[model samples]
Target chain A: AQSVAQPEDQVNVAEGNPLTVKCTYSVSGNPYLFWYVQYPNRGLQFLLKYITGDNLVKGSYGFEAEFNKSQTSFHLKKPSALVSDSALYFCAVRDEYGDSSYKLIFGSGTRLLVRP
Target chain B: SAVISQKPSRDICQRGTSLTIQCQVDSQVTMMFWYRQQPGQSLTLIATANQGSEATYESGFVIDKFPISRPNLTFSTLTVSNMSPEDSSIYLCSGTGHYFDNEQFFGPGTRLTVL
Candidate 1:
């Protein structure tokens, strides 16, 4: 069975400082990782994905994630956090093995609070 | 990215009644999925809507309780039958493109409150 884990329940950061949201996965095959952001009462917005190549994948809003194959981690990062960046973040993974359904296994979300 | 939209942004329904939420994608998609997000919880896949066939439900979800319909590639519906307070949650519709284009876009979820 494949699963995703987000260690942090919430992360608070001062505006203009860097921020990181940790994510790890357990999959049998090569993992297709993704990051999504959800605002209050809004749908999830696709931030970025790592399918193949490029361990460091850049996403929307100056956000980037480093995919560590050995460590099985894909952590979301930002150089300078903004108040507008405060939202809920979810890390999801899809198994690229036998199943082609493209069903996503999501992690427990991490709430990001960027204080002004 | 595909633009997905869901009807009835939010609704308050009486217990024992059923609510049918509609999902429409701006363009044709290869796959459409329905998810449930309870208060302060992560999203859970409810079922996968298959065009012209029966929906494939995930564990803990049933056809009678949550019947899905995908008449076409661009439209689908999820009906929550015999609703209860526990069924109160945000139902999200998602769509993904072809094999190479695998980014799954989501609808602005339908918030259901059972009373």
Candidate 2:
């Protein structure tokens, strides 16, 4: 079975400061990880994904994530926080060699609040 | 990246009523998925909408409660039947690009409120 865990329910960051949202996963085989952001009353927007490339992946809105295979973690990071970046963040994982018909498993989600 | 759209951005219905959410993609995709997200919760996969075939539902979900249809590669629908207060959630439709590596794009979503 594949699963994702986001330990923090909320993360607070100051404007112009770096921020990080922690995420870890459990899967049977090699994992495919992704990050998504959601605003109130809106759908989730794709942030970035870790398939099989470099340890760090850059994404939209000046956000990035580092994939650590040994730690089984994919933590979202941003160099400078913006008020507009405040939203809900989700971490998802899928087993690369598991059931071909399976869907992605998502974490409970972490609420990000960027204060000015 | 594929652009996806969903109809009825929001709807309020009484108990025992049903609401159908529509999803349309700008480009044809091999896999169309329906997901449910409760208030302040992460997305939960409801079913995999397979074109020209019956949708494959996830555990704890049933076709009777949430019937799905995939007439083509670019369009699908998910109906929430006999809705209850517990059924109030945001339903999202998602799909992947042609390349396929488990990366998915999502629609804006339809918020359903059952009274």
Interface RMSD for each predicted structure: 0.8, 1.7
What would the per-residue lDDT of candidate 1 be over residues A10-95, giving only the tens digit for each residue?
99999999999999999999999999999999999999999999999999999999999999999999999999999999999998
TM-scores vs. true structure, each candidate:
0.98, 0.96
Most lDDT-accurate candidate: 1
Task: Give stretches of model 2 more than 4 Å off.
Answer: none
lDDT of candidate 2 at residue B52, scale 0 to 100? 95
Q: lDDT of each structure?
A: 0.95, 0.92
Tens digit of per-residue lDDT, candidate 2, span A1-116: 78999999999999999999999999999998999999988888889999897999999999999999999999999999999999999999989898776478999999999999
The window of 10 residues in a row where model 1 chain A has the poorest summed lDDT is A94-103
Superposed Cα deviation of residue A47, candidate 1 (Å):
0.1
Candidate 1: tens digits of C-alpha lDDT, residues B8-90: 99999999999999999988988999999975579999999999999999999999999999999999999999999999999
What lDDT is reached at residue A50 by model 2?
92
Clashing pairs in 1: none
Each candidate's chain B TM-score?
0.96, 0.95
Lowest lDDT 10-mer window, candidate 2 chain A?
A94-103
